[model samples]
Target: MKTALFELADQVLFQNYGKRDLALVRGEGVYLYDDQGKRYLDFTAGIAVCNLGHAHPGVTDVIERQARQLLHVSNLFLIEGQVALAEKLTQLAQRGGEAYRAMFVNTGTEANEGALKLARRYQYVNGHAEKTRVVALPNSFHGRTMGSLSVTSNPKYREGMTPLVPGFEVAETYEQAVEMLDDRTAACIVEVVQGEAGVRPVDEDLLRRLAARAKELGALLIVDEVQTGVGRTGRFFGYEHFGLSPDIITMAKGLGNGIPVGAILAKQKVADAFTPGLHGSTFGGNPFAMAVANYVVEVVRDPGFLERVRQVGEALRTVLEAHFERVTGLGLMWGFDVEDAASWRKRAAERGLLVTVCGPKRIRLVPPLILEEAHVQEFEAIVTQMSRA
Candidate 1:
């Protein structure tokens, strides 16, 4: 019966995504169940979107309350939830350097879109419209939207989307990035750890140099922390790992604890690039999204919450590295270089576990931060036993 339903879904749905055959009906902390009551340990955390875990009581309660009150509204009016969320995010960004402003949107891609626009607008507003070129690293994943796709370096993802938005170039090394920068370059954006590119962490020195060069070239340094932010990397933002301040920081995924939300945190001066009517979104900063995001922020912002993430992440990494060739990343955003991620994913799923693959060999492990050591041990044991087989 379940197999027939899977077949029906495969025929009906678009073939763009490589989806598994399992159909999840319900989820709880660190676990998901199919229609037949077959349970699976949810290590992927819905691809890092459900940070507080599936159906967390607090998050679900907030969502239910807010949904009943107000679901969405246009950006014309001054919404209370939007204002409160912005204030909370602004306070988070101010942890290392100055307090940066935030622009709310509806996904990681939208966040990147706003960041790209702000970069161009900054150059224009600062009397340098000719400086429109943006430099991004190779094998980086921002999102799938056209504007974000333009900066993404994976040819496989961007192949069909030809004639990509211009003024974008790929930089492999620090030297390559430096050469790409010129009078026409408006910003250099890079992910501290390339998530989809197989959990590769960029060199700290390279990031420091890139920040310095961006300053020298008078271009903004945009850090795309969409996958690594909000306590996933043991810190509020991935940039905190390197002890550097980015001029612009784009975020999503886990911001609203599964409610679609995105934001751009920028330095006050550069943030002023967009005037009131320069750009807008109808559903951006809607009341319901903001209210849910506020609750998500409140939960993740607790000091002890992130500290536990670090401790559990390290334990998971140590266990994984013992079996796999390499395991890397910070906090709960972990990945390992297994011999074959696809096969392992299938096997793990069959054994009642959920995981994700980054490449042919990279197994991404982004579980909920609230997960305990027992859950980590179960994940480790499952993958370890499968690898040996």
Candidate 2:
């Protein structure tokens, strides 16, 4: 019966994801249930896409209200929610909650697509069209789209998709990245916390060095905050924790708290790169996405919200480190070394815990920001058994 349903799904939809056999029916707080009512402590949190937790009342309410009132309006027409969401997001980025323009898109990949375009066009308009090389780090996962795929450094994902956008370079070290930066480089994109790269956090000194070098070479420093922004790393923006300002920032995952929305925030001067007729999207910044994003940003940017995430993250890490030899991460986004990740994942699933595996030796724990102590303890117990096994 399960195999039939899975087969039907595969036949209808293009098989990209290795869809787990379980079918999730509903979610509340930090738990998800399958069709047969088997509950699992949801530590993966939709791969860190549900920061506010599942079925959050506030986010759901906004979606419902916006759906009833007005769902989508074309970019040609001005919408209140679009303007409001942009303002809120900008305020969340700026220190005093000041004005900064935002260009919305449908997904993180789309946001990076727009950002790359903006960076290239910005340099072109300023008489540096040759500044089109993009430098990204090894083990980086930007997005699946063509432009983003070019800078993405994973060969596994890039294997068949060859002859990708030319002028893409991969840097192994900060010094190597700096060497790749020159007058011809359009932008250098880096994830604050390398989410798909085994939850690796960039060294602080490297981040500062990259920013300074990007400024020196006239290439825009594009911070891909898709997985690390909106309080995921215990800061409004992950770069805030490192004390550096990026020329451009792109985000999506948790911006809508489960709804699809992506945005690019740039410095006013650099943002001016694109003019009226230069770029746009049909469903970008529609009412539904905007309303949801507005609510998420307000809640995530609150003073106490991220502090709670940090506190819980430290506590969880302490428990996790005791079980595993190495634990790496910033906030709730953490990964630990496991002897047999596949077996551990299977055991956790059998024991009613939902998680994700990273590489062969790592287990990732990207729970919702609102996970309680009880949930943490429960997850800790499950992981401890794996350690002894």
Candidate 3:
């Protein structure tokens, strides 16, 4: 039966998310409870944003304490939480003890947009005003905004939004992406793993070449870690797996566990282009978000915690490989090919397992970072039950 909430939502809300049937009213650990009080084993952790799992106690405590202490404050004055969080991020993001800086925003898209701007600003400020174009990879997903969208390659996203921000283009092929880097290019943005494109891993050799070519051509390399940062890939940043150095890194999902927050961590030399008056956000680095994110990083960046993620991720990958075809991904993130993806997801949901369909025959699993081996066994049983029918 359709709930009154759906009916009321139809009357009042925008229909951007398409037709919906499930309405989760509560969450704890890796489970979600619907309005009808049915329990579900969630494999999609809010599309990779809830890495610490739903309703994490540590995040809740930070939110409560921060809310009571101080919530909103303008960027006019110094924010201690932001400073502390930045220190942790720069430390975790250390590259041979090189200095790095960060700018916080509310979403991953914003982080990308800011990073792109920083790239161009760095070039322009250095007297290379002609270097304004950006090169993005094919099948990459950045954000919904204009600046980020310009570099995003999916035609479905840019269907009618022509005349996008000037000088931004997607290379037709990964090899061409390297060739496209030149004096006119401001930066080359890429994702370590194309999570939105069915959790496909980008070509490592091509990426290394891209980074090398961009550096040779005086263009910056930006790694968009939106879906892969904060332990989603069993590492603090997905780029760590590649062993390639990037000038700027954009991340948002899983940073605050649940609270909306994003940031751009760049090498100090490149980030310094954004002077005091260049860019600013009113609510980006507020104390509340800073506190929650600080707590999340402190927990996720622990060597023991990350090692656990790597071990469990390998176990989960084994289970997926055994049960499904073309299973690909790292850490807690994974994708597999199955017939009738929509129906398969529906069956899983009906059986109290939650998954997301990313393509016609692709289903993605981005379970919480804290997922245990027992959860994998539970997931196996559910899939086994569905496969029989």
Q: What TM-score fits each model? A: 0.97, 0.96, 0.99
* Candidate 3 deviant stretches above 4 angstroms: none
Model 1: lDDT to the true structure = 0.86
Give stretches of model 2 more than 4 Å off: 1-3, 96-99
lDDT per prediction? 0.86, 0.85, 0.92
Worst 10 residues of 2 by lDDT: 92-101
Best by TM-score: 3
Rank by TM-score (best first): 3, 1, 2
Question: For residues 127-192, could you state the per-residue lDDT of candidate 3 as single tens digits?
Answer: 999999999999889998999999988888898998899999999998889888888999999999
Predicted candidate 1 versus true structure: per-residue lDDT over 1-389, tens digit per residue? 55787788788988787766778999998899998899999988888889988899998888889879988768878899878888888888887577788888888999898899899999998899899999998787888888889888888888878898899778776578877888899999999988898787889988898888889989999999899988888888888898778899999898987888888889999888888999888888898888888988898889899899889988888888787787788888877886788998889998888989999988888888888999878987887778677
| lDDT-best of 1 and 2 | 1
lDDT of 2 by residue, 77-106 (tens): 998887887777777677753345788898
Model 1 segments more than 4 A misplaced:
none
Q: Give the top-scoring candidate (lDDT).
A: 3
